[model samples]
Target: MNLFEDLRNKIGKSVAETGQASKRMIELSKLNYKRKEKKREADRIAEEIGWIAFLQWEKEQDIRVNKDLKSGLERLQYIQNEIKLLDVDIEKVKSDKLLYSDNFYPTSNSPSSEPSALLIYLCPYCAHQVGEEDRQCGNCQKRYY
Candidate 1:
């Protein structure tokens, strides 16, 4: 009877520890997902600002006076703040655990040859390669304009 009681206690502790670890993993994943989303939005807004400034320069207009550029800057700031908050949450969830950056492994996909003469343009939304004449991204279908 004593042996059976000790075995049951050990099993119960293992189950509880596994459940807690699973819950923490789920929380961490959710936080990381939200951080990625915020970062993507920030990237899009920064790209928009760059494009607006370029267009203004091409038209010989003042980029500072561009309303779209100003708006994109404000949105980018907001997204950056959100990313900071998500980072805090992720750190809290990952307390006492090794960070993703702690384990580093070199990737095997490095290019060995020189760059090609042809330049490839990637869509800002989906990162799909598009021709210079493409008005919309084929992957995301988002208009370039």
Candidate 2:
């Protein structure tokens, strides 16, 4: 009666939580992939801007007052700003700590070659997921321990 109902509740909660965590991990992986893609794009844009700016300066002997140079500079600044914006968005993703949930296992006496568990880290400031080997939190960009 009451005991059976309580057991059912506990089992239901456990199953639901496991499903939610699995779904969350999939979403987090997708978000991180997109973040890395944006970073790559920003790096490419920066290189292109540097090459254009250097060529313009070399050809014109001055970059302060040329119309075309002014336009190029504006474009470069725009892309740089875009990179900054991308970084901000990535930080926001990192700040969502639920993305970094840990998977753990119960202790077993049977001998096995594979490890039983792994450690998952959270950003100290924003509580976002971080790696044990990471130098800084991706979300807050802060180093903790």
Candidate 3:
């Protein structure tokens, strides 16, 4: 019967969606762990820079020309850049979890054949998910208007 078939299809779709969500969660968790590790490395590099500065000061040496300090600073900058890149990558992964097919396509029972466009807005500061009618970001508490 059509009713039984529809119910079976719905259950199958739900199971598939749950699986996809679990995969996405695992991907996000991995990315977040990487980002946290990068932050920790940044902190370590910062501590190294501080120690370098302290030693240079104790020796009454010119801090600007210190090769060790310079290298540490460079490494810190590189790590910061890496963290920024990871942030972008995390946002990309989050966006991929969106149900684009459901947003764009009409269901089988629908009379209209044309696909509808769904506009998704994100917070500028934190990339938090926001609705089109939202005036403020819920995550960052930043005002859009």
Candidate 4:
């Protein structure tokens, strides 16, 4: 009878120890789950910050690009204006040369061969030379005497 009582006592102690170990394991598992949740939350916040920083960078790039484009267009406009002025100057030089050459070589029908005090009419629309008896312009169809 004494041996059976000692065996029962040992069995009760072993059951109690097993229950305590099970409780400890449950607590440890809960702690691990909480840590994982905290880490996930931190990662989410980091992602949001990164997105905001990217948007700001994009805005700055847009401003710089716009400024560059505006400057380029202004430079192009200035160059075009200079080209137009140069073309006008070239036309004036050519007209002056033509006048000088014509004066050097007088035509057979020039005013020098005509009688003195000869009457001539000029067309007002196209500046065409006309005879004194003419009443209409032949080049631009304008009426002029």
Candidate 5:
């Protein structure tokens, strides 16, 4: 009876360990998938910005012939601003994905026991915790309150 009990205990432990390992593997896989998705999004945004820049350059060439330099310059500036905003967005997405990956697959052997704050940085303008810090708020770009 003792031998049978010990065998059953060992088998149960092994099954539990295997289940934990499988769960960990799935979590790691999810992190990898998220990282890849973020990279793809960044690449797409970069390509879009590149195309916009090229179009603006072409428009500038047209302006020289049509004698509408001012409008062309303005449009170019707008496109540049848009590209900057897109770049910032792409960076933010990438940063978020990395943070998520870190939280999912921590390097430390011991798991964190403390509860993490769900709230991110509060917007200086509107006092909203939007989980990102930037010069302008996504909701309201007001520089000052």
Candidate 6:
């Protein structure tokens, strides 16, 4: 048996399947974390709603909810909507992973095309893609927090 040829074949096969399935799973995890943060924000808004209502009651005995409480409730609703959208995004990521097969071949669009996932920052205002070391976004010219 040609030992060198066998070794090369095995290594080539391993290199071909870089496991996008795992990458998608990792992305799903990040989406879940974002969803959890939104939920926490909603909880905080709920607390603010209650406190504002109590203050209005203590002042003049008005049973009608004030604009402050209504605004807080609207904010809570917006946060919940965000959480739902995240859930949809998580599902889409998972479904895309399902399309992956173990016997995949290498294409020009390989894993090397992807930058280091940890070495990039997305702009909060506009999608100004930049490296981790970048302090400002090139497209939007916004300072990264």
Best by lDDT: 3
- For TM-score, candidate 3 versus 4, the one ahead is 3
Q: Residues 12-117, candidate 5, lDDT per residue (tens digit)?
A: 6456545655665665566556556655655655565556556767777432223244444455565556556656655665564565453243323676542222
Candidate 3 runs further than 4 Å off: 97-145
Task: State how far residue 52 of model 1 sits from its true place (Å).
Answer: 0.8
lDDT of 4 by residue, 19-93 (tens): 544655565556455545544654554555445555656777433324444554555455455545555655565
- The worst-scoring run of ten residues by lDDT in candidate 2 lies at 99-108
Candidate 1 local lDDT, 61-120, one digit each (tens): 565655787788899998999999999889887863442223221122463232112245
TM-score of each: 0.63, 0.47, 0.64, 0.39, 0.42, 0.55
Clashing pairs in 3: none
Q: Quick one: best TM-score, which candidate?
A: 3
Clashing residue pairs in candidate 1, if any? none
Ranking by lDDT: 3, 1, 6, 2, 5, 4
TM-score of 2: 0.47
Q: Score candidate 6 by TM-score against the native.
A: 0.55
Clashing pairs in 6: none
Q: Give the range of the ten consecutive residues with the poorest summed lDDT in model 1.
A: 99-108
Model 2 C-alpha lDDT per residue in residues 1-145, reported as the tens digit of each score? 5435545755664575566556656666776676577567657666765676788789886645456555656665775676577667656655543333343322234533432233446667876656778878777778778
Q: Model 1, 111: alpha-carbon shift in Å?
A: 52
lDDT of residue 43 for candidate 3: 100
2 or 3: which has the higher lDDT?
3
- The residue ranges of model 2 lying beyond 4 angstroms of the native Cα positions read 64-145
lDDT at 3, model 2? 38
For lDDT, candidate 5 versus 6, the one ahead is: 6
